[model samples]
Target: MTQQNPLPQEDQQVTLISVRDGNISVTSARALVVKAHKIALKIDTALSEPPAWTDEQSLTMIYTHGERVMRLRGVLREQVDTDRITVEPVGEVKEGDRRDYRRADVDARVYARSAGTQSPTEARAAQVALQLAPTSNAFIPQVVNISGSGLGFTAHEVFSAGELIDLRLVLDQPAAALVNVIGQVVRAVRGEGDALNSYAVRFAELSEADQDIIVYTVFSNHFAAEGLSDALDDFDE
Candidate 1:
């Protein structure tokens, strides 16, 4: 009975998942295989920040081989700097199903405030007023994940489900976009940061044009992550 080998070849692309900014920001870091061992792996990654392991002291890789995609989960063995990590494979390697990415995991800035039963029209008017004359009451939240219809952010402001809120979203990727929209709190859960809660809000009756802007914002990063080599090349410089 000889030792098992996980990967036999090299130069394969893998999505190295990691969290940073005190776990307030989670990103899908793309990494290429630098070396493969009998039971461990070393990868070269492009992470925005140093690896901050989540609740589990492990590293997960979404590896695409042939036409089937697979996930390799293992505990962290080393930090090698240069965004590299050695993972000791824990379980057997197997192919996993490919998913249609609905939400983009991001770390953009968003400002939110509780609306307290205001209609969408009223909330929109209030958002515009604050933009012209910004107020201290505005809270900047770290966006965890976002889609066109809803978004989740971690902030100190506690909001109960079903309450209305106004948001000023500043998108600076692909294109610059400053959008104001009304949303209803759908969920709130415990998260990182000093006195923070993760709030999920669904856009409430957004106009067709406004909805389009958000949809583009959500996918812009997705495309940039898959291709757009120039976008990332300049990032390192």
Candidate 2:
């Protein structure tokens, strides 16, 4: 079958639906429920992480009346026949709009704290990975440009512009450890190909504890791995 991108611009809301063989079918933005005579599906609601990108996994959906929702896995066969399913791309998600972009280009410093070491670059990298959750699977965001207020990177997922997401940055070293910060998704795209969809997100808020950890990391780096080194180096021998 032919694949096409239905979005007009970057960060536009887009959705891809992969349905189980003979379970549900979509044609031109309309979904049809089908009956599968050969496949047996079991609904699983407890999976914390959805199946990996390659895995033929099924999502549970509530059906009509007394029957429980069924779990539908990935497509197993060709679109015309058999056991496999297909992933249909739906364009124009309504999740967010341009006005929802609160800090897309704000000049705010972003940092990281892992196991207690502090490096602005490393922290920032960790922040990017954490915010891109599930989508940051194989691709890593490389900071192509940075500014006093905002930065930009190559994103791996087609994130809707102005979407919001929580992040958990981990800092762990031989001497210290911590995870901090939450971020909001600013923009994302699938430019050129699925592999090149760059995402751009900005730091929105940091908790007091996270702020302390960042300060501690900076001090450790400045003081040769010594905690609070920058704040206490004046002491006499």
| Candidate number of the best TM-score | 1
Off by over 4 Å in 1: 1-101, 132-141, 190-195, 226-237
71-187 per-residue lDDT for model 1 (tens digits):
565566665554555566556555543231236766556777787655877777776676532233453635457775678887767788888887766655544455677888899
Considering every candidate listed, which one attains the maximal lDDT?
1
Tell me the TM-score of model 2: 0.26
lDDT (tens digit, per residue) of candidate 2 on 60-169: 22111111111122332223222223332222112222211212221122232221223434544555565433233333423233211223545434446554433333
Task: Give the Cα lDDT of each candidate.
Answer: 0.54, 0.30
TM-score for each predicted model, relative to the true structure? 0.47, 0.26
Could you tally the backbone clashes for each prediction?
A: 0, 20
Name the 10 consecutive residues with the lowest summed lDDT in model 1.
228-237
Residue 81's lDDT in candidate 1: 53
